[model samples]
Target: MVDLMEHAGANPGRGTYGMAMAASRTVFEARRDCAALLGVKDPRDLFFVSGCTEACNLMLKGLLQPGDRVVVSSMEHNAVTRPLHVLSGRGVRVDFVTADTAGLVDAEAFERAVAEAPTRAIVCQHASNVTGTIQPIGDLADIAHAAGALMLVDGAQGAGHLDVDVAALDVDAYACSGHKALLGPQGIGVLYLRSGLDAMQLVEGGTGASGADEPGQPLDRPERYEAGTPNTPGIAGLGAAARYQSAHGAGIRATERRLTVRLREALSAMDDVVLLGPAPHDESVPVVSFTSPRAEPDRIAFELDRRFGIAVRSGLHCAPWAHRTIGTLDTGALRIGIGHGTTDADIDALLAGLDEVLA
Candidate 1:
């Protein structure tokens, strides 16, 4: 990754020189690795963007027009909800399937929402950012297909952690942050678009094509969406990260799951602590969120960081709807994000710090 960043500094997809070709290859390798990481069949099916926010915007704004409806889960992050809100002001009908207290969306309710009207797409997050509770995307995708609507997923929390095979899920589109769970650098993301499906151009600029004679952006596969110079170095780092995940993902998954169970067991034992989200099980990711009536969320987070040097996030986790679903909207939550580098010792340290904070 460092070597590629140091050497492949030229602009990708625009130059004819050797250095330019090298940069292009660097970017393509990133795309290819990320594609494999997500079980994407064709590398061209994905597009690089600033982050999942942009991907969400592209999926909502680019695809749905006025009066076109989209069904979404109430547990979605602001990235998906805010865009739909903006579109709603523009006459787009956005229907929501409210999740139960356990942060699980009901498939029958979702199907009922879809059946109420002509839905252009069914958009949802693959998992809750606050709770790490994985949604039943496969079941929802089936509902969308039965209604002849596209199934789009916000994979920011579930991309590298869960089963993300686009074919098996029949997902028409997926947007995710590479930095979150894919172990990639920040400012990089992928938007997976099924072949033959189309989203309006997110941006319009030089596609590194021969000429700009054609009016409007070219309606080609990837060129239709990807525009301007991409972050070559970031792509290189992401490619390396993707390759690393591919090689050691199973082991990493097991470790994360074990640590998550450890955290859940320890936290649930405490009298003052109230755990949020679905019950710990095999069908979940490693995000654990909790709250204590004895301590404020920020103070707990501060004590844990200052005393134990253990980092955890406190607040809404950028998904108030999720917090609401789990009955943590007003007080927010303290989220422990167990990642690739997290170990038993780290979880132990967190639990110990939490004990002190709540005590």
Candidate 2:
């Protein structure tokens, strides 16, 4: 990545044939790797963006117009919900399907929500960042298809941790963050659009192709979505990360799940701790959220970091609707995310810290 950046820096003429050809090859390779990570057969179906948030914005703002009704799960991150809010003000009707306290969306309720209106899209998370609950995406996608609505999945948490097959899930589009489960750099993200789906371009600038001369007409799939100078370095790093995951994702997920189970078991055993989201053995990512009756989530997080030298995310996790679904809207839960690098010793250390803090 550094080498690529340095090369680009040395040759600042991005429009030159040599630089343009190099960047184009790098971007295409990165897109192909990202598509492989998402179980997409065609590399052209994928495009790069700033992050999941930008991808969500592109999907919501670019795809749906005024008076279009969209259904979203209650456990959506701010990425999806916030955009929906903005679209609502612009005349798009957004309705939410309720999830249980375990953060699992009710299938019947979701079906009803889709059936209740002429929904244009059904936006749902593959997994909740706050609760680690794995949504029934295939079933939801079936529902969306039945209602004649596009199924857009937010795979921010699910991409690298779970098996994500765009064709098998039959979703119209899938958005994911590179930093989370993909173990990639922070700035890179990926969005997979089913072939032949026309979406309005979110950002427009020099595509370094013939379309740059003609303002309105853009190039094909990825080039249509990616505008301006490409993030070659970030994309290169992301591709490396994706390749690493492709080789070792199963082992990584197994390790994360083992650590998560241990952490959840310890938290659930504590008398003062109230575990939110799915049970420890249930289908979920390696994310765990819990709150203490004796301590505020913020204070617990602070003590864990300051005293135990352990870092964990706290508060609403930018999913207020998830908090509400889990019955923790007033007092948000502390989120403990077990990643690919998390170890059994780390879980033990976290448990020891919690014991001292909650005692």
Candidate 2: count of backbone clashes, pairs at least 3 residues apart or interchain: 0
lDDT of 2 by residue, 266-323 (tens): 7888899999888878888988999988899999999999999999988889999889
- lDDT at residue 80 of model 1 (Cα atoms): 92
Query: Candidate 1, TM-score vs. the true structure?
Result: 0.97
For residues 119-225, could you state the per-residue lDDT of candidate 1 as single tens digits?
99999899888888888899999999999999999999888787468878889999989788888889888899999886888789888875578778888767778
Of the candidates shown, which would achieve the greatest TM-score relative to the real structure? 1
How far does residue 286 in candidate 2 sit from its true spot (Å)? 0.9
The deviation in Å at residue 232 for candidate 2 is 1.2
Note the clash tally of each candidate: 0, 0
Which run of 10 residues does model 1 get worst, by summed lDDT? 275-284
Error of 2 at 302 (Å): 0.7
The C-alpha stretches of model 2 lying farther than 4 A from their native spots are 8-20
Model 1 Cα shift for residue 134 (angstroms): 0.4
